[model samples]
Target: MSTLTDLRRSMVAEARRRQRLTWLISAVVLVALPWIFSSSFSISIMTQIGIAIIFALSYNMLLGQGGMLSFGHAAYFGLGGFLAMHAMNYIADGAIPLPVPLLPLIGGVIGLFFGFIIGTFSTRRAGTVFAMISLGVAELIAALSLIFVGFFGGEEGVSSNRTKGPDFFGFNFGPDIQVYYVAAFWALIAAIAMFLFSRTPAGRMANAVRDNAERAEFIGYSQRNVRMISFCLSGFFAGLAGGMFAIAYEIVTEETLNMNQSGAVLLMAYIGGVGYFIGPIIGAIIMTLLRTVLSNFTELWMLYVGLLFIATVMFVPSGLTGLLMMHGPAWKRRSLKRLLAPYAAISIPSLAVIMGVGGLLELTHFAHTTSMDDRVMTLFSIPMNIDSLLPWAGLIALFIGGVLGVRRLRPMLLDAWADANGAGGGD
Candidate 1:
């Protein structure tokens, strides 16, 4: 019994040490990221990533922690953003004495206010009913934005100048780097707060209610209360993100509160793996890069994102983080190296398929969208004539060959995965 107690203590100590190390590494990364990508454009993208991280994590509080799938969480986000934009305008006019750094708090308060009102009714049910109610609220708010154009700014949306606000220290947030730091600071605070929330008894109860509400109720807990708390918290963080968005872009538009915006956050949370706290963070990073970087190069970025989402849902229901975590057993057993070769083997065909499909998409898109004179399209740094048969044949061959290759190699990869994970090792 003494030995078991010591072992448990050691395990707990190790976990604490690991958690500290992770936070330290994250801090270093956040501080170093600006210098690593010194361009203003890159800093802008990073700032957006930080905002996305906050938003995605907030959404996870609902879907991941509370087992509530929200199709309209962006209502809080948009509402917060709109109000923040208005506040910034007031600051510019010297109407409000609040500093720009504290603007997100206003967004949080607004989010909490709305979340309470919405959750009061929405949290009464779970599953499909809750989702539908959330959707209805979102649509109602979205329509109201148009009807009440005085506040929502109609189609043009509300705009504000961040530099017009009171300065923080010696900085007026006139530069992208300054805004990035502000965003990073808020994001760090929000992430840590959300993480702490997840460890609280209320948070655990939220999970219990999520998994089995009847069971939770039988244990002297009100499922509605648990869910309501989570919803409000989620709204606060999401609104905080919206405030960041307002500061970053100096504008809040109706599009920010639209169905598309809500859908994007959903994609971030779900694709990132709502099961893990860090999952939405990873998803936010990837999706932001896809939106800001990939869209610059391709018109079909949304299509690609959609395909990736579908693939994740079908093959990796646990999200990207879950997929990574799946290898923990093999890593712990010191057998991860054994799967490297199999992974490499499978990656070849996977790359082929991705390139082939993307190339075909570009080719077809170019053919339909451009004039006959614009027949040649550059792909992989090589010029290919969309009007010619050679490029089509090459892409088709690559796709077919990749499909065949994957079909042949999947079983071997699975067996290797099993072996690496110790399922086949008799350990």
Candidate 2:
């Protein structure tokens, strides 16, 4: 058994090492994805992903690593977005430097300014009290957005043009693809920076404070200071993400400063898995994909997402990243291979059923603008039509099959997860 354990550990270590290399290669691939793909829609998706990635990491800084929850996070995001837009206008009008790539810095400063002011009070209390104070803060700022029409632009919001910047060797950000690269670059940078922050001493101290405030204080770390630092850092990066938004869409509105944006970020970060950095990245990617791609398919996407969120909270508290990681031991033992066929069998049909229903619903409603329109996108060029009773019958059959497979496989998956954890006393 010890030999098997050693072998498993060695194999796992080897796999992890290879995964690192894979990631590096994948990062390069992603950065160049714009050049490779000719679709303008793809670039738009990538830009949304970029903004989401930064936003998720920033939220995680509050919830995941810091162990604090703030329902009013949108205040900073909106402020940052608003300020960045102003910065863009300043540059465009020759009031500031043209080709302003440092717009995120301006956004961060705005976020930190608020964080500095608010942290003075909110950092005093942790948990529920802290959450409420943050909510109040968000509401206050949201109200302020309406009142301060001159700066915030009230209901009309603020807009800017990126082409107003200086031409860098005659490369104007006139095209969406060019802007996509800039967004992707910043997204990657923000992700790497946030990941590094988690490994920093301050970040670890935040974790210590989160897990046990009394013990962290007992160890000579000021819990107050720890919380303050976390709040500020979270605001800083969130502002940066907001800046990305301001630049990406060229607009900042009350909606940005509202509870909905904050709630979306909270949901994304938490559902991705707060305990893991990669979790938010995954969460952000999934949410953005759903928002940009799935929503175009069906208005009912939110309903399904809500159901999935509830299911995750109830059954998979750790989110998708954690659930996937739960299979580590079985993977190490080479036993996980046995389940691959079953997983594919279940997942493929299930995805088809879910996405098919979603796609058909959108077609009926005429909500989508995908390349896969009924008139253009035919399966095997057979002129498939989903606007009929036959397609509905197939959908019903698929749904029933997926439900049955999931119910049957769920218990087995749970057992395997338990085995994986117990096998190595993994936390």
Candidate 3:
């Protein structure tokens, strides 16, 4: 009994140590990143990433913990931004003597208010019914946003001057770097707060309701109440993200609260791994980077994103984090190295398949859409005319070869994985 007690204490101590270490590492990285990059564009992207991280985490609070699939989560986000913009404008007009940094809190309050109103009824049902209601509410608000031109500012939306607010320690936030720091600070605080919330009794009940609402009710807990709490909290954080977005861009347009924005956040959360606390953060960073970088190269970036989403759903339903965590057992068993060769062998063909498919897509798009003069295109430094058959044949051949290679090597890869995972292999 004494030995067991000592072992339990040691385990608790180790867990605390690891948790502290994680926070320390995260803090160091957050503080050092801006200085490490030190470029205007990099700073801008990082700021966007910070805002996205907050947004995605908020969505996770609903879908991941509460099991509420919201098709209109962006309603709160955009509304929050709209309110924050108005607040900023009020400060500029000398009607309000508030600091700009506190504007996000206003957004949060508004989000919580709306969430409570919506969730009051929406939480009565779960699954498809709740999802459809959320969608309807979103559409209603969107339409109302346009009709109420006095508040939503019509199609042009609203804009604000961040410089008009009271300065924080003499920093007027005129520079992007200052804005980046402010966003990073809020993001860190929001993330830590959300993490703590997940450990709370309400959060635990939310998960319980998510997993089994009927069972949760059998234990005298109100499933609707748990969901309402989660929904409200989720909305508040999402609003905070929206406020940051308004600050970052200095403008809020109709696009901010549209279905497209809602879909984008859904994609971010789903692709990031809704099951893990840090999954949305990873997803947000990857999605933001892809959006920023890929748009510069291809007009079919959305198409590619859609394809990636479908693939992730089919093959990696747990998202990128799930894929990473799949390797944990192998790592612990010290057999991960045994699978490296098979993985390498499969990766080359997989990459070839992607390239071939991309080439075909580009070729198809160029042929159907581009003018005659623009028909000639360069892919991987290889100039090819869309009017010709050689490029088509080459791409087809590459795809076929990759498919065949993957098919042939799949057994070996599976065997390697099984070995690494300590599964018995057949002769």
Candidate 4:
């Protein structure tokens, strides 16, 4: 028993050490990223990613931690952003003496206020009913944005000048780099706060209510109250993200509160893995990259994202983090090497399949959107004559061959995966 206790203590120590190291590394990366990327565009992307991280984590607080699936969470986000923009404008006009860096707090408060009103009724029910109510609330708020043109600013939305706000420590925050740092600071605080929340009694009870509300009720817990707490906190953080967005872009449009924005946050949370604390952060970064960087290269980016979502749901419902975690047992056993050959074999065919399919899609899109006389198009940096049958045949062959190779290699991968994770496996 003593030996077991000592072993457990050692394990706990190691976990704490790892957690600390992870945090230290993350801080270093956050501080160094702007310097490393340097470009204004890169800074903008990084800033967006930070804001997204906060938003995604907030969404996860609902879907992942509390088991509340919201379709209109963006309502709070948009409200927060719109109000933050207003605050910035007020600051600009000397109506508010607050510094620009403090705008997110205003957004957070607005989000919490609205979340409380919405959550009171929405949290009365769980599951599908809750989801539907959330949707209705979102739509209602979205429509009101148009009706109240003076506040929402109609279709164009509200705009403000971040630079007009009072200086913070001799910096006006007109530069992208300065704005990025501000976002990074808020993101860090929000992330830390959310993390701490997850470890609280309320958080644990929220999870309990999520898994078995009846059981929670039997134990004298109010399921609605637990969910309401989560809902309000989620709104606050989401609004905080909105404030960052407002500061970053100096605009809060109707699109911020639309279903699209809600859907994007949902994707980020689901793709990142709602089960783990770090999952949404990873998802936020990757989704931001896909949305910003990948969109620059492909017009079919949305279609690609849809395909990825389908694949994640069918094959890895736990998201990208879940997929990575699947290798834990093999890694622990030092049998990871056993699956490398099979992974490599499967990856080749997969790459070929993706390339072939992408090329075909590009060709189809080009043919439909462009004039018929535009028979020549570039694919994979190679100019191909779309009018010719040879290119079509080559692409078809590549796709078919890849499919066949994948079919053959998949079994091998499965077998290796099983072997690597087998009970008796070792280095």
lDDT of candidate 4 vs native?
Answer: 0.91
After TM-score superposition, the amount by which residue 307's alpha carbon in candidate 3 deviates from its true location, in angstroms, is 0.8
Indicate the worst ten consecutive residues by lDDT in candidate 4.
Answer: 418-427
lDDT by residue (1-427, candidate 3, tens digit) is 6999999999989987987788788888988998899999999999999999999999999999899999999999999999999999999888899888777888888889899999999999789999999899988888888999999999999998898887578988779998888888889889988988998999999999999999999999999999999999999999999898888888998788888888999999999999999999999999998898888888889999999899999999999999999999999999999999999999999988998999999889878888868878898789998888999999999999999989999999999899999897532
Which candidate number maximizes TM-score? 1
Instruction: Give every collision pair in model 4.
Output: none
Error (Å) of candidate 4 at residue 204 is 0.6
Q: How far does residue 167 in candidate 2 sit from its true spot (Å)?
A: 3.5
- Local distance difference test, per candidate? 0.93, 0.81, 0.91, 0.91
RMSD of 3: 2.0
The C-alpha TM-scores of every prediction are 0.97, 0.82, 0.96, 0.96
**Candidate 4: regions farther than 4 A off:** 1-14, 423-427
* Models sorted by TM-score, best on top: 1, 3, 4, 2
Better model by lDDT, 3 or 4?
4
Candidate 1 lDDT tens digits, 80-122: 9999999999999999988898899988888989999999999
lDDT of 4 by residue, 261-300 (tens): 9999999999889888999998999999999998998899
How many clashing pairs per prediction, in order? 0, 1, 0, 0
